[model samples]
Target: MIRRHDVTPAQFAALAAGYGGPETIEALARAQLSKHLLLIKFIAEAWVGARAHRDAAVETLTRAQAAAPAEVAELLGSPLVGAWAADCTRRLRGGLRAEIPLDAECNHLSAIAAAAAALAGVEARLEVPSFGGRVAVPGFGLTKLDGAAVATVACGRVTVAGAAQWLAPRTLSATSHGRSIRVTLDDVDPYRGGHHVPPTGRLTSVDGWQAVFAEAWDLLATHAPARADELAAGLRTLIPLQQVDSHSARSATIRDAFGAFGLTMPSRATDLAVTLVHEFQHSKLSGLLDVTRLSDPGATELHFAPWRIDPRPVSGLLQGVYAFLGIADLWRRLLPVVAEAPQEYAVVREQVRWGLTSLEGSGALTEAGRRFTSGMRAVFDDMAADRVPPELVRRAERKLRGTHDAWQRRHQTTDSPARP
Candidate 1:
């Protein structure tokens, strides 16, 4: 479990009053911060004790989730409780942390009982559940596929049966027993991150993602003729080659970001596409290290997207993030053949068509141009020679030529000595 601090009673009462609204978020956060926080709050509030806190506290938590990600509903203490509150609102039997990290990168899961042991200042290891590729064991028939832990949180019991919601670019899943709840999430962004994706089909060694990539790319090519240029530009940046996933573009959160990547899609397809793009971008960027930084981490950053602020001025930082999103968006929009390649999987075909219709016109993503234009130019040199439109290709060139004038106008560094 990721360790954290505690919360105070006064803090709990102060923030608990505002449970489910954006009034405080709107006022406290910048426009960019506010937009992403809305999504964070939506998912976070759905997790266990979120409902107990005041709207302000939840809003504060949401903001922290987005900007101060290092501190989500961590072990911060709230005096009103016996021990400390993981969150101001999440008052467990004794206000303790329930999450435990299972893997090196903190991508695995462990039970709460174990977490409490460590939290009680006992420093014990928790026994976590296991499911690797839903294998057919000696006695068992079938099981879950292999993947990292996608959801982990603490709370009083919530819904009986775990309700899975894949709203797109956003998702919410909460399972409660009696007094506690475990709500896992992705996000719904004005310009938000798509996260916590489930497997669409499978990506084992044999019937792996590589095959899925070629087929999905071909299918998407037919519908998104306008995106072809963007697609080609993105493809040229990859290192080894693009490898798409089985049941390509079938993840839950990706559904909402279909339009942003320039794809006309249904819900399910969009979801899968969104995730595939993210993974694919990661793969490709690794291939293109010499290419540019316009491309960033598709896996680490996008895999668990927190929330995105939507302020116009903050677009500069947003631009850095959008560059990667643009690549994933393209990947999602372009992969549709997982369904048709019956030669590989028949059910996948049906699922693809079904999802495309479900996630229609969810949202359009702006090209995070400011940051990537340079990166794009650097990596796509092949396109640079002829693939890129002349005017577009000349962009960085012009900027470089006018560097002196630009520096005089915008450089903020001071040359004068400081006076005490």
Candidate 2:
């Protein structure tokens, strides 16, 4: 059965303000679950309509749901599953062929069912997709069977013929001031791609990743407890990407895959914390956009975003504004404790201020989007008022001007105006 999710006016305002509490995060999660459920239903119906092979995976999933409703629901709510379902539906809708055989793609449902059955302690036999001799049980670990494609789940154990290796799921944790954050280091799922980078299959060792994640969590919990609580509630899966350099990492969030971050390993805990907060803000806005109409579906206008090299659409501009708003708040809270916070806050405050200006002038925003931007403006106004050293403030202004000039020069030949 499909469930209806709603955001009250007060909840909407709080979320738009960029500091929605944990409860709002939970509500957004529920809304995402509902969306995933609808997508799964669409996939099933489309497959049947196409006269595709009928697999027993759906039946197995139904059995698991009956036996352990809560556990099964949690498994189905996984972001990887959401990604798979969305991709399959899109391919089917567009009459596009999947990279894998349709039957193999259909078997992904079986893998999900097998994982659910194992969680529920139900015996089940199913043939799941195998990628390069690896079978990934969604929401769990991966089992390598060299050439095997079928998986058997019995007594809460997953096994396949000629199994040669097993990699348990990795998770990292950190706590401070009676608050803790735990997240799965998901490096094994085949469908974990589309996070803006190819998934790095499995890590040789998670020790380094664990240390950095723990330090990052501690930083958030100690200084930004509210954001920490939000992380504990909303951040679930971290998809590791290949590091770009010793000091830099690339990270992105998928609109369809809420609660999952695809990121390279950061050398510093501060970088990791900021990345988590920034990506999670994107996730929150994505979820809100799902339930509400924030922008006109037909409106098309590009605007200058100080953070990006090219002009961005109104929707993209709004996303940047919201993300930097969170970063600005993070640095604002860390100002007294961390020496670099003032400089960091000044930089993001300027970027966000520029983005908000672009968004406010955009003709693409719906009434709800306008209200949301206003809430963000109120938050930014507070952060902008924070006293930074005169030198740092001057530095930020100079940087903004330099970026704007560079952007204008780059887009001068284009039809769209360089500034909003």
Candidate 2 ranges with C-alpha deviation above 4 Å: 48-54, 95-98, 146-148, 245-247, 413-420
Scanning candidate 2 in windows of ten residues, the lowest lDDT window is 46-55
Cα TM-score of candidate 2: 0.95
* Cα RMSD for candidates in order: 21.2, 2.2
Estimated TM-score per prediction? 0.22, 0.95
Compose the digit string of candidate 2's lDDT tens values, residues 322-380: 99999998989888888789899988888888889878888889999999999998988
Worst 10 residues of 1 by lDDT: 77-86
Q: Top lDDT: which candidate number?
A: 2
In model 1, which runs have C-alpha deviations exceeding 4 angstroms? 1-271, 278-376, 380-420
Q: Rate the local accuracy (lDDT) of all candidates.
A: 0.26, 0.82
- Candidate 2, after superposition: displacement of residue 277 in Å? 0.7
Supply candidate 2's per-residue lDDT for 232: 90
